[model samples]
Target chain A: MKKLIIASTSTVHNSGYLEYILPRLTSFFEGVKTILFIPYARPGGISYDAYTAIASKGFETIGIQVSGIHEYNDAQEAIANAEGIFTGGGNTFELVNQLYKNNILESLSKAVLTGTLYLGTSAGSNICGVTMMNTNDMPIVYPPSFTTLGFIPFNINAHYLDPDPTSKHMGETRETRIKEYHVFNNTPVLGLREGSWLEVMGDTITLKGNLSARLFQPGKEAKELDSESVINL
Target chain B: MKKLIIASTSTVHNSGYLEYILPRLTSFFEGVKTILFIPYARPGGISYDAYTAIASKGFETIGIQVSGIHEYNDAQEAIANAEGIFTGGGNTFELVNQLYKNNILESLSKAVLTGTLYLGTSAGSNICGVTMMNTNDMPIVYPPSFTTLGFIPFNINAHYLDPDPTSKHMGETRETRIKEYHVFNNTPVLGLREGSWLEVMGDTITLKGNLSARLFQPGKEAKELDSESVINL
Candidate 1:
């Protein structure tokens, strides 16, 4: 069984992505022979190419075009045979849709439990929650329920941050947005800021990033933690 | 019955409060009778004497020293007879908790329906959600299940914006934060930026502010609108 490495995206267009994850890739897939890429998130869009290009940086990448229960065979084969699985980010809603449409979330979960070396970033990081209800993106599209891959016990608020003073778009501040998530959820939410990554190696969840990560527990003050802290799942 | 106005706070400071609301006060209360100010939000803290100071602006402002349900008599009476109601900005979680503890959210909702001129800034603005589940600030304290005044059918994501390039805080971007909201919610959430006010008069909801307000409907593209455009909610 391989380990699961979930990450928040730093940047895909620049050297940041490689700089952030290269060391982790070396530590996790040190002796692995091959890598399989699941780029279903981009689905008929331009990001497919973008992510495929990004994933190709570390290993031999293959884009999985699977998208429904009928596509389960292909998904299973990809997960079962790949030395490591890399899931890229895009739109969480779109990712959930494709995963559900193909009935692959469950398959992927099972694979992770069996040690498939599961790797996810951004939107991919969101699906690892008990329910992917706490993502930090828009639902430009929907699949079924916002429920994600469910590899992790708590909800992940990916790409979290405080607002920029110069931004012109009007919307809820990040803090207010997460608080609202507590209304429907009893599970804690991990507000993972940009440049942060959670390394899930053999049942251990370690926080890796600068600044304090905010944790929301119902009826409690938001807890902040530095990157070196280890959060027990 | 009085008219109701809820403004999404862009920034929360002593001056920000006065600049954003002074216009609404002059325009709405123009020829009206006395204004009853509810300063129940401050609790025991007398930092700025915000209540008396706001009252000194020439309105008959009375501080509601009530904290729990036992001291909620004036809340009912004030809502019933006031020419107009203005709920100033402070901590929304505190305001919501007080309202719930006092059993006044429902009453305030009724007052709005009956046509009380209602003006809620910051924390006050947050309580207008159907469930009060919508708010953009940190959940400093937990309140009863995300329920609010319900003046607005959907949730309010106040002070929405992108991430600050210079700030050190780590969290998800505002766009991703709201996208997560869409996963569990079917109702649209209005990302009302600071300095933005949603004027609700006799069921007419208009988006007014210097910036464009973004509206997110689950499974649809986010829509942006500028000031003076009416929202049919």
Candidate 2:
């Protein structure tokens, strides 16, 4: 059986790091004393140690200790031995690049599939999808491949935002970008709004959090899925 | 001599397509007849013919004719012989993919360098830079490489926007994204805001338009380059 909590973002507006989801994390990570952290996304280009410290502090409140994967001599072994695993968010390209560089993408995917407890937020959660095509992050780095863990059937557009009706900006809105994505990609995409997450237990996945998520299918009108809805698609 | 009008966007807020910069374009493309159009970006996934039609209409306003490269017997020959070339804005990934697939990247770059007049809007202008790594586009398709024309010494963040002071959205700001890019990339980046453009004549490049553009260099503070400023870096 597989168990994971994939969140759209670690922090919401007016909240501390991971503060909004601490309670859920506490329950989800119950009985796990320490978890391995993959901090390669390096939000704002922070050092891996510094990023891990933040994740450590966040998990600390839940009475769990966090160790960065970079701190280990054998990152594959770290993922293999981790009772619980947490991947932090940042630039998806960098995260995917590091995953390839460290040659641990397979190990991480296998661990999660074999039922190691897992938590992913932002870029971390985006990897659970079919590809990183839906990410909003700038292409700061090029990964060996756009393919990801494929833990979920579809791809994720984390920090998904609705178009501002009043804005006059000409940049493609999130919705427009994803639509462009559908032009070349057949994979379904889930636009995960902030404060929203998906709780996956075995083959059943449910939208957890209070917000509704937007789902996009190629050549189909986008529809909103309410919280707690079963997201089989 | 290199002659190019690399603009941040073709349309500004509340304006007709290419209306904001028609006068500049008329003078920039002086003496040119039919300009070759690269519609590979295909905004909204519009068909190549439909997108070319839009470009034809826009160029027609300036007494110029437009023909999409797709209509040509050989795209490479079309680029090589074009009196003036215009690549319209759309998805950067798809644009680069087509450029690579058609084996015209080198020809287009060589043609532009050999003194053919050219105009690039949004994604098209972004390719004039050293790499597409700074692009704020979704990775709808993968290209052969992030390397680009290198017409300029740096990279470009087209359709660049300023951070909203009031917004509480946790998504990384445009500035932050570029900053993260600098972590792994050493190239200088110019944040070409909407309604702004760069005029390149021979070896001289000047920022044109009413607003100032932001310049980001590795390990240094970002500064604003006002209208008519020379952008040598």
Candidate 3:
């Protein structure tokens, strides 16, 4: 059975890194002793070792050791043997670029599909979708393809925010961007707000956070899915 | 001598479309009678004809005629013979995709380099840079390459916004996104805030409007370029 936790963000406001999701992660990774961290996203252009240390500190609270994929000489072997896997967030383009360059995209996808405990945050959660087209991250680097793992049937817009009613900025809002995506794509998109996550166990996927997530289907009005609701689409 | 007006946005808050910039545009296109409009970046997914009409209406105030590039049988000839060219704001990916598909990228670049008056707003202005990697638009469609006209030595981040200090959203800010770009690219980036613009005449590029634009150079702290200041980079 496939098992994964796709979160909008690792940290919420007024909290330390991964503090908000620690409890959920603990239960999700129950018997796993160590997690293989894919820190290629490199938020703020952080070094692999430094990003790994941060993930390690977060996993320590759950009594699990964390190791970065870059630390391994054989990345494919590392994913194949990982007890649990956690992909951190940063620039989605660079993350996907490195995955293709390393030629381990298939290995990682296989591990997740074969029931290995998996956790993804932000850009990490984005790849769980059919494509990286819905990502909000800047295209700092161009990937070979926009195709992602397809761990889920739909696409994810992480850290999804509603347009500020009072703001005067002329840039397109998050909702507007997603609507534009639908013009060129028919794939359904879920706007995963911060503090929200989707828990996938076997064939069932349930929203597990307090906030409601916005679901956008092609040629249809966007609707809000309440917390704990099963996401059928 | 290159002559171009790269604007941050066509419409500002609480203003009619192109209302604020009409006066400057009138003087910019002084003797030009008609402008070739590139409506590929259709805002709100509007049709090419409809978008062209809006541009036509706006240009009418300056006593200039407008014709969309799509209406022409040969886009290359239209650009080559254009007295002035205007590329409106919309999705950058789609705009660039159409540019390459129509095989007019080189022709348009050449026209601007040889002293034809040119104007660009938002996504349009983004292409005047070295690459479209710094644009804020969603990747609705994949373009062949991120490489752009390279009219200027640096990249332009159109509709550049400052980080909201009070927002609880955890997504990367505009500044953070630009910083990530510098990690993989040495190209300098100019964050053109709304209501701001760049006036390029000959080899000199000067910042216009009352607002200051943020300049991001690799391996250095981002600084603010005062209004009317010459952009040497």
Candidate models: Cα lDDT each: 0.64, 0.93, 0.94
Model 2 / residue A71 / CA error / Å? 0.8
Query: Per-residue lDDT of A153-188 in model 3, one digit per residue for the tens?
Result: 999999999999998999999999999889889999
Q: For candidate 1, what is the lDDT?
A: 0.64
Error of 3 at B9 (Å): 0.5
Deviation (Å) of B146 in candidate 1: 14
Candidates ranked by lDDT: 3, 2, 1
How much is B19 displaced in model 1, in angstroms?
7.0
TM-score of each: 0.58, 0.99, 0.99
Evaluation by TM-score, superior candidate among 1 and 3 = 3
Every model's DockQ: 0.11, 0.88, 0.82
Off by over 4 Å in 2: none
Ranking of all candidate structures by their DockQ, best first: 2, 3, 1
Order the numbered candidates by TM-score, best leading: 2, 3, 1
Best model number under DockQ? 2
The stretch of ten residues in a row with the least summed lDDT in candidate 1 chain B is B62-71
